[model samples]
Target: MHDFVRTPAAVVAALVLAVAAAATPAGAAPATPRWDHFGYDAENSSFNPHETVITPATVGRLKKKWSVELRSDQSCSSYGDPIVADGRVFISDYLGISAYATGNGAKLWSHDWVGSSNSPPSMAVADGVLVAGYTDCESMSDPNSGLIGLDVRTGKELWSGATAPLIIEIVIDKGVVVTAGSDIYNDTATVAVRVSDGKEAWRKEGRRIDVTSANGTVTGRDVNGTGTVAFDVTTGATRWTVTRNLSTGTASPAGDVFYGSSGDGDDLEAVSVRDGRVLWTAPDNDGVVAVDGTRVYCSDDNGIVALDSRTGKQLWRSDLPDHGALAATVAGGVVYTAGIALDATTGRVITGTPRLSFRSIVTGGVLYDSDNGTLTAYTVNG
Candidate 1:
């Protein structure tokens, strides 16, 4: 009983387009690579596997594309590496946190805070949520620290909750936000909360547990700084614990090993994650350490050294112009440290790479460098 009417071509095309749009998933992965964590992910590997643009061949042509000024005052300085995700970049310091466009450095939205005295803020972003930590500068005697989650696209506040007295680290993984820092009583604590509702999942306190997560386990060094304990990230159940004479630094986790320094500062040791047994040790390295699939990178008083991940054999070493303590990030077959690029395999400095005052992060075909209060973006020139 339907009338036989011929539909217009334009009308038919519009109807087909609407149906296709509705079938797309709301939580699809981003089209471009993202540097979404403090060390790129919950493992704190400091290596971006998705990066493909700033390779050794193209790094020499990187030129500044845009720059933006951040809030600089007596209370705040740009604290750490810029976090990039969802087509925007986020930065946090002692004062507050802000977001900007990744392509042009345009200000998108910013949330500023007051009374953040000596405690600098920390931030982590995942699944379109940006979580930031704040301190109670008003009460220095018994200071209160907390975290706030925001909608990454619109800067909308989603949820906020209080945590330990000092939040030194924040990592988002498996839909949980894990924070590690000192508690009100000057004891180190690690707390986990759900990212969806900001509800407390579990808590571990009474030690200097510098925590990092991988798979479903959260591993951290114990109160003595020489022992490590692995816990179930969801229930805080102790999985394993081991004590050794290891140096007191944040352990960077790779697939099955935790890379750390020896107590005497003369060697780098790789400890197995399953049983906390020492795998191998490489000598003549100390300071910040980063790891990729095949090589482990470390910075010392001399310069940067690369060691085989499995056997702890030295591959190469490249000297920086001025080096004391430096941060290292690896991406696209290039090792970025102290604002310069070195070939990942050879440890040779890229000839024309610009030297930055602070450590820089490379992702999505751009180099993000922050100094004092200035944030600059560099792209490979034609």
Candidate 2:
């Protein structure tokens, strides 16, 4: 395995270089890419199309820019994945939800829930509002689960609205915030609320965990069984239902295609989001699926596998172990898995890439990784 070791002298040198790069002439700098949603967007695609840096050629030069200690110990937990928006990064955990400056890791603002617990919460940001879903600490059997909207710039509570129960996922699209999860009574639901005022727009029961919105529709898994369903984002009207059990987890949507695993075997399947038709299945390749414009990426027993999006043909496979738990984040023609960077087309590891001990997201020419109570930022040229 290729790795980059950072000694004390190397760290200081990297810091100086990062400071110098940040002093570049103002107008000459490119626009920084923003990851505004948990999975990068409403479709949970986990791919950044606007990234102009951190490509395979430059990934090996990545250096630590900043880091923040989220907690002192590992007993606590981080709620949802960290999201970057409007020059800041937001993260929720057992302590509370906090925002930090993406450039220097400075704390901008934070909000503490009255009765926060270990139960995970989901969050998404849009239109200057950050929507977070949480379960009150009263009782799990009859918990007061709901969504709260906060000012993304100031972290002030704007409004709160009720929802089903444990919110497994949240997505925002079409001027609404959509949430999906079930309660202790086994009543699963998908709820949508206005992003401006936290008012219920529509609610559909029987549609269970994990919701993703894109292309005028919201898709989720079934409540009682292992199927998938789609509904109109504005009116909660059923668009289509696929009875086939695609996967036990969430599916990543790219354009009109939904990619997921079957959970029963090493097969990654692609289904049409319009009609739930099985487009193709790539056998012996399954685990967290990420789709870009032309390829589908997933983790299997052997490592990371890339498939042709249209025909499900295996394009390339990288041989690595213990990668099944890491999701692939594609940006600038490179696939990032935990700490490894690989050529998206050829599946070759980029030598000297920093080996991170946790999952990471690359945006704005920097990589942000959080694990074991620490969030760190890396960049090739600050």
Candidate 3:
């Protein structure tokens, strides 16, 4: 062995090394924020615009782009998720909708209406038209529903119309305006109207609007509100609404429309409209996350699991010891279940589940209300 030699200064420096290490900054780049809102996009595309978000290691740290908070005292109670477009983000409170500057979360405009706690989410901005839904208290069991159209360039109401619906979902197809809602038997639940003047072009005699696809096809339920229906993009005619339920996870790929229940139970099914067939189902399932073309990532409120999207086969699972999942999202070849990550190919937990800044992960990012509501973006890297 070589002879040992140490200077007095060198010995002193070694004792101070621990202090320096803890102060080191996270040596990773920040991740791009993801816009994974439900019911897809303006045209109902489940495909997230930020499709590259695949892995935990690849996810960069992120800060809020902007946010608008509404207290129930102010008219809403964390009741719904906000919608994003071009550069503006739209938020809906128990009262109505607000348009905000996405770059800075500044309030640009606000709209309101009195609705129940179970009010469905609604919003759309396309070709200079902004639309939102409103409830009709005319009847209790089956009331009329409608949408308000506004000038997309400026938050101004352009036109208003009636759908005779209860719950509504709006989308654009091939440059045409479309919206749907639930109605009674022999009821016109799904209706497509011209965005320019809010004129009825096609109205399915009986159906309910649940979710939509980018291509304009819609997925919904039947009269009782638990079956399934896929209405035409252009004519509001019935494509097909199977009896199965749908999966409610992260937004799906663009134009992949389906329906399923999320309140509870082991069964959650979502079919694709591209071919009008049952795409996948989770029978022994707990809750689910995002599904890429290849694999379906899922978790119970306790652990993470993987399934083959095409065949509904089990891939693998990992322990999520303390927390439950929020939504499963995939980007950069890694799968995110709630907050943890599993290798896409091996179904192994590569990273432990992360603590959430907030429980409402759908609206965008979450902020700690303690530190003056410090908004923290839930991302892979930054």
User: Candidate 1 at residue 142, lDDT?
Assistant: 75
Considering only N, C-alpha and C atoms within 3 Å, which residue pairs clash in candidate 2? none
Model 3 misplacement above 4 A: 1-37, 42-55, 58-60, 63-79, 114-120, 136-144, 168-188, 219-230, 238-282, 286-289, 298-301, 318-326, 329-382
Per-candidate clash tally = 0, 0, 32
Model 3 lDDT per residue over 146-230, tens place = 6777775567777776564554555555444555544564445566677677777777645545444435565556555665556
Predicted candidate 1 versus true structure: per-residue lDDT over 108-219, tens digit per residue: 9877665663454556776778877766567667776778888998888888865654776665667877777775676777777887778888887764344355555656
Which of 2 and 3 is ahead in TM-score?
A: 2
- My TM-score estimates for the predictions, one after another, are 0.84, 0.83, 0.64
Error of 3 at 161 (Å): 2.4
Arrange candidates by TM-score, descending: 1, 2, 3
Clashing pairs in 1: none
lDDT agreement with native, every candidate: 0.67, 0.68, 0.48
Best by lDDT: 2
Please tell me which model should have the higher lDDT, number 1 or number 2.
Answer: 2
Worst window of 10 by summed lDDT in candidate 1? 1-10
Which run of 10 residues does model 2 get worst, by summed lDDT? 1-10
